[model samples]
Target: MPAITAENPLALPRVAASPDRAAARPVLAVTTAPSGLEGEGFPVRRAFAGITYDYLDPFIMMDQMGEVDYEAGEPKGTPWHPHRGFETVTYIIDGTFVHQDSHGGGGIITDGDTQWMTAGSGLLHIESPPEELVMSGGLFHGLQLWVNLPARDKMIVPKYQDIRGGTVKLLASQDGGGLLRLIAGDLGGHAGPGATHTPITMIHASVSPGAEVTLPWRADFNALAYGLAGSGSAGAERRPFRMGQSVVFGDGESLTIRADAAQDSRSANFEVVLLGGLPIREPMAHYGPFVMNSHAELAQAFDDFQAGRLGTIPAGAA
Candidate 1:
C-alpha cells in the first residue's frame, strides 16, 4: 500500500452511474439529523453529520451551528483534540474558528471561510471555542464533516486547506438563478481551489425559492444534500423537506431539486452541501478520534502517538 503524503495522496474515485443502476427505484431516504447533547461540557446539536453510506460514503458525522457571539477574548469553539485516519472539513457560515494543530497547519475559519484538514496518520489539533452560541438570542449555524481515508493512506501526515469565501469559484445554474461552489472537484465547468487527493466533490449551492436544479449522478457513488435554509422537495416522490433536514439520493442518473416558495416568508434562499464519492466497502473500526480497519491498526495509531512516529508539530498561530 502507498503511504499517505503529498505525492501518494489518498482519495476515493468517482464513477458515473450505469444505465442499469440508474433505472433502480428512486428512494428518497430521509434520515432525521441527530442533535448533539451535553458532551465534554459542550452542548451541541447534530443535524446532518454521521457515518452512513446511505448518506455520504467514506464520510462520517456532520455538525452544525446557526450563529454565535463571542465575548471579547473568550474561547467559543472546540479545544485541542487528537485524530487519526480521517479528514475534517469546517465550513463557517457565521462567526470564526480560531484553529491550530500539531502538524504544521493552522488558521482561522471566519464567516464564509472553509478549513479542510487531513489527519492521515495522526495529529493533535483544536478548534478555538466561540463565546456565545445563543446570542441575545440568535442561533449559530455552520457545518463540520468527517471524511475517512482509505486503508492504504491512513498513516499519512496532517495538512490544512483554509479556503476563503470569495476565493472559492462559483458556477451558475442552468437558469442563472442559483450558484454553486465546487470545493473539491469539478462540477460541470466549476472547480474549487482546495487541493484534493480523492476523486471527490464537495459543493455548496444557493438556490432561490421555486427554482429547480438538476445534477447528473451515477451509481458507483452515493449523494446527499443538507438543507441549510428554507425548505424544498426532492427525488421522484417529492417529499417535503425543511431547514435542518437532509435528503439522500440512491444510485441514479441525476438529482432534481424543487424549491418551496411557500417557505420564502421565513427564508427565500436555501443553502446546500452536496457531497458524494465512490464507496470504500472496507471494514471500519473507530475510536473517539481515530478510524482504522481493525483493532490492531487503532492500537498501532495510539502506540505511534505515544512513541512520536507520526510527524512534526505545528508552528505559531497566524
Candidate 2:
C-alpha cells in the first residue's frame, strides 16, 4: 500500500470540511467487487460490476489490478487493444507499469504515479510490466478507471498526461489522522494535477486505525468510496466495508469514513479510493472497448477499428 508517504503527515497542509452545519452523506449501498483475471491473466476486481450505471454516471468501469505477489517470471499484462469515447486513468500504488498508445502518448508510471490517457476519437494501446519488474516478479497493485466523455468531447483530439507521484497534492485530515492524496480533479479549493474532459475528483486516503476522515465535496458530483487495502466504516451511520468492497453515498455536502479500531495484518492503515464525478446523464451503448452514444456509433467504431483507421503499432515496437 505504498501509494506515497510523508515523513510527518501533521506537517502537511490540513483540510477540513464544514463540520458545523454540513450534512454527512448517508451510505446508500455497499457492494463487493468480484475477483477475476484481466489483461493476460492478471488478477483483478471489477469495482463497479454489480452497481447500476446510474450511480456511476460519467464513469464507465474500474479494475483493481492485483494486490498479489507474483513469482519471478510470472507477471503479465494486457496486449495491444483499441478504445474510444473515454479516458483511462491508471494509478499505480505499489508497482510499475509501461503504457504506450498509437497516438504517441505513453510513459512509465510507478508507485504513487499516474498516467492519464484520453482515447477521444480512438487509439490502439498496450499496458505491461517493465522488463525488470517482470524478471524480478514482485508485488503489483494499482487501479485503472474508465471515465466517459460526453457526446461533444467523444470525437475530440486525443491526449495524455504523465502525472508524477511528487506532483500529487497531499493534504492531512483536520485532526492529522489521515493522509489524503488528491490524484485528479478538485477538492475544496485545491486542485489535482490531472486534467480531465469531465469534472471528477479522485483521492487515495490512508487513515490510521481508529481515525476518522471527513471531506468537503461538490454537491452535484456523485460520491463513491472503495476499499483498497483494509477495513473501514463509511458514512454517518457507520456502515462497515472492507477490501474489494465499494460504498455509495447519498446526496450530501460532505463524506465521512472511519478506520476500524483494529485493522488486518496485511496492511497497517485503512486505504480507500474516494471518487466523485458530475453525471453525464446520457444514454450509453457499450461493447468491449468502445463506449458510444448509440449502437450505430458503436458499429462505426468497430468498422473503423477493423479498417485500421483507429491507429497502428509503431514500427519495431517493443
Candidate 3:
C-alpha cells in the first residue's frame, strides 16, 4: 500500500477496486505489431514484431518485443522517426541498440538497460543497428513502450533516462523463485531509480514454474502484462498465456500469476513485464510516430521538423 498523495502527479498508489468487480473482461482486446513489414530494404525480424497489450489508458500503444538475430542478417530494425506529445521507454533484455534523438541526447543501451525518452513538444529520433553489432548477426532483443503525456506537459522539453542493470534493484520471493525487477515506480515499499514525470509503473517479473506471485494494483488505474517467455495462467478465470502473448486485467483487486513447472523439463521459466497507470482522457490524433490531441497538431509537428526549427541537435545527440 504505497501512499500516493494528490499532489504527487507521478505517484500511482494502489487502491482496491470495488468488491463487485465488474464482470471479468479481456485484458487485451487485440494484439498487433510492426513485424513482417518491409522496412528500408530489410525484412522485419520476427522478434521485433511484438504482440501488444493495449488496455492501459493514457497509453496509446505498445510493442512488447524486438529481436536481432545476426544469423538472419536481414537488417531487421526501425529507422529514425519523429514524435511528439508522448514518451518512449525501451527495455533491453538480450541485445543492444543505439538511440539518437533530435535533442542530441543519445547513447548505446546494452542488455539489462532501460532507456526512457520523453519526446515532449517535438523531436526527431532513430533506433537502428550499429554496424559492429548488426554485422555479427548480433543477437539483440528488447521492448519499446509508448506513454502519453498530459496535455500540460505535452510541450515540455525532451528528456531521457538510461537505467542500467546494476542501477535497477530486484526483489524475489523468500519461499519461491519468483523475482521482480523494479524498472520504474515503486513496489514492495521500494522505489526504482528510473524517474518519471508521469504517473506510471513498469515492472519486469520472472516466475519459476509452479510458483504463484501476487501484485498489488490501483483501482483508478489499468494494468497489463506482457509474457515474453514460457506459458502460464493469469487474470480472472485463469486465462492461458503463451509466448508472444499479453494479458490485461480489468478494474480489479490485483494480479495473481502462476507459472507452470513440470518435472523433467525446464520449469515454466517466463519473463513478464507489467505496466499500469492513471489515464489522460484526452483526444488522440496520431500520424507516423507523432501522437497529438488533434490532426492540426500532428500536422504542425511534421511541418516544424521539416523547417529545422527543432534547434540545432541538443547537447547529447547520439
Cα-based TM-score, every candidate:
0.81, 0.98, 0.81
lDDT of 1 by residue, 1-318 (tens): 000112211121222324443453255576666655422333345655543654565777676654333344433456567789988888877665567777667777765788998888788777754444323333334678878888887877677888887777656566644566667766654567877655567887666677776666644667777777778777767777766677777767667666776655545566667777777677888888888889999898888877766644555542
Task: List the candidate 3 regions with Cα displacement exceeding 4 Å.
Answer: 1-35, 38-54, 72-76, 262-268, 311-318
User: In angstroms, how far off is 181's CA in candidate 3?
Assistant: 0.9
Local distance difference test, each candidate: 0.66, 0.92, 0.66
Which 10 consecutive positions of candidate 1 have the poorest summed lDDT? Answer: 1-10
Tens digits of per-residue lDDT, candidate 3, 138-219, equal: 5656777888888788899988988887777666643445667778886657787787777777887777778766666666
lDDT of 2 by residue, 142-178 (tens): 9999999999999988888899999999989999999
What are the clashing pairs of model 2? none
Q: Deviation in angstroms for 287 in model 3?
A: 1.9
RMSD of each: 8.0, 0.9, 7.2
Which residues of candidate 2, in runs, are more than 4 Å off?
Answer: none
Q: In model 2, state the lDDT of residue 310.
A: 96
